[model samples]
Target: MDEQTATEAMDNFTAIWNTYTLEGEVVHWLACSLYAACRKGSTPTVGKGLMEGNCVSLTRILRSSKLSLIQFFSKMRKWADMSNLSQDFRLRMDRLERNFEVSTVIFRKFEPIFMDMFQNPQGAEPPRQPRSRKHRRLPCHISDVFKFCWTLFVYTKGLPPLYRADGHVSSDEPPPCVLERLCELHDGLVVEAKGIKQHYFKPYIQKLFQKQILKGHEELLTEMLDPQNFIDNNKAINREYEEYVLTVGDFDERVFLGADADEEIGTPRKIIQEMTTSQTAAQSQLQQHVEKSGSLAPSTPLTGRVYLKEKDLLVTPVSSATQSVGRLQSMVAGLRTAPSDHLMQIFKSCSRDPTESILARVKTLGQTFKEHYTNDSDDTPGAHIEILYYKILENVIVQETKRLHGRDMSVLLEQDIFHCSLMACCLEVVLFSY
Candidate 1:
């Protein structure tokens, strides 16, 4: 691709690719954008084939861009940790501190302090209030991530097994695997939040970056807003991280606006304020409330998405020439592997009709590979999934399989993966479940 074309492709795909980079390596993904851009509108040719004018081999570039196994996994193992995960944890934790800052301002402080400076209401009764300083919110530092996760770990029902897996909790330090799982939970939280964010929050980009609602001082806001404010000559990305400015104690002053602008304690909505009297008459009948118990629905199984790893994954031995490439890939990358007894039995149970067998397996798999939690206050099961978790043994797998074809806004990942991975699932579910 030409340099200009490549730059445009990078810009267009950056945000979408950013989500992937959160979970994978950053280096090779540019190759993805480049590969897509070259084929965008022009081109009838596809695959590892050469681009017409540039004569560049797209496959070669993509293959070469992958990360080296030496960087993480051993020649024998399936997976390893990367520095990017920890780096992202710190970065996202810092960003969250700033994002929530705008919500921390007190209602009383809004009128006199923030509203006076920005809105400048006429005939206000504050007598030109004296300046005061107080903490608005707590600093959410990288240390806080570990601290909160440690709290969760302390009471987690599953933690004992995890702790014992690494020895005991009464050592010089807590279990390292627990720490790893803690970070995994954080990552999963960010993933789910960002999905909802892209749907619900990003449209109001102003609340994220606007200055008038939050800016107390023009110069400071301008300085913080500038991407180049704190850049180092050697850094690949901007050092400013301007999102951090939101946590510097700026709040949305608009809370004091609307019908309640003049109210002393602030306006109340029609809830109880509109009631004719504080004490209600029998004429105003009090109605009993009723609630419904919806049947529990576990998440659908994720299938299909067996893309080539952008980095090294499982390394199969040389002697296993009879082993399927699917089996080798199952270790870390592909959803293909040798069938487990559970899976073989699924198909064997109904050899006359594979469809019935597949659907049954889907239900069981869906019910099994799920997360669970517990609380101390109730006699209810410690495993949140509970009897429902094993409901698969009876109706789970079949129920999930019936849902295999449907439209859902939320299980987009599961839907996409299910279709893509359906053919090879018998080989993959063993590891997928484990």
Candidate 2:
């Protein structure tokens, strides 16, 4: 390096010596770091004020994208969920931005659908939707749309990258979320759930309140989680979080998907022990892998950073089938045993193999469709949703025929069916709840 350049660099380093510590190009941003503390109630580590600093407005940063709320936040939500932020925040995300324009537009389109999903409108047609977006109330509560998105975001940790203001998805897919099944369980439980105490949720919550789970709060929980008193969780916010050297705790999954605790509620002890052993084995393997490479490569300087953007989304349609089956099984959990297995068989039968002749495929599935249309009652799981699916599929088929250029999903189906197996795939996926 030039002597002049070296002298200038040394002078600059000397000026900011209090702000950062450097030892042979290593930087410790002691007080001048830009990384702001987010998640609202996070406590400081390394004495107080370590992470306390001036903040940049993430909302302002996002506004530069000029995208709708769903589009802008959808990808970020997915990344955050993948990072297990839900486990940290416990579904308390920042409030929705004041984009009533986009939220109201989607709500308006789905108002009639939500209203009549439960009850069949007694007329030749459903109620006419209001033309004005400014109306405070409509046929269905506008908050229902927000509620749907909120529930979906909390459970699944994401929403679809919706492009349209009228609540249409970019793909010819069914509704992005299968919320009916979840709602069914909640509604059923709510009838019996007079209050938090009535559900006996505290016992299950108590098991998770271990120091290994919440960390450092072992003593605090003794007093905090006493029975006959409301657990003041707000006071729990001041506790700092700690991480191990190499791996995320295997209990991370427990925190993310509390299904294990839910399942063990009334389960046999032998089964729970066996499941616990299996989980321990799996986690040991994961811990070994994590130790080898760690969370980042060359973990010396800790310079690795990540930014969430629209590019990270995977656009496959398999998620539809997965959620549908989950929703169907959940909705029917009280009514039937082995609903998931039965639903899977039905879905497999409805969607034929890709290599099969279109005529043979359609003819066999067409027969199945006729049976469904004739036999299924409107009160059944996904009965109304099935109609909505087929109706959308019909519209998709029409649009494909008239479009100048179309994309190919399957070669054989595209040759014979013109629009390809999107229609067939849609049926298979939508049939999850059906």
The numbered model that scores best in TM-score is 1
* TM-score list, all predictions: 0.18, 0.17
Candidate 2 per-residue lDDT over residues 219-313, each given as its tens digit: 23333323212112312321111121001111111111122322312221121112356798988877886799875344566545454356567
Candidate 1: regions farther than 4 A off: 1-83, 86-89, 101-274, 278-392, 399-434
Give the true-structure RMSD of model 2: 30.8
Candidate 1: pairs in clash: 303-417, 304-420, 304-421, 363-396, 363-397, 364-397
Instruction: Summarize candidate 1's per-residue lDDT along 1-434 as a digit string, tens digits.
Output: 46766776577457554443233454444554554444333323457453332334432443456432122122102111221224443444344334323322323332333222233332333333335686332223222222222222212211123222222122243222232343353333545544433433322222323422322223222332222321221121111111112122111222223333233113232311222353454323332111122322223354233543545546556433325434433433422223334544544444243444344545444434432322332222222122222222224344443443222213322243553354234325432332
Q: Count backbone clashes in candidate 2.
A: 0
In candidate 2, residue 19 scores what lDDT?
Answer: 45
lDDT of each: 0.33, 0.35
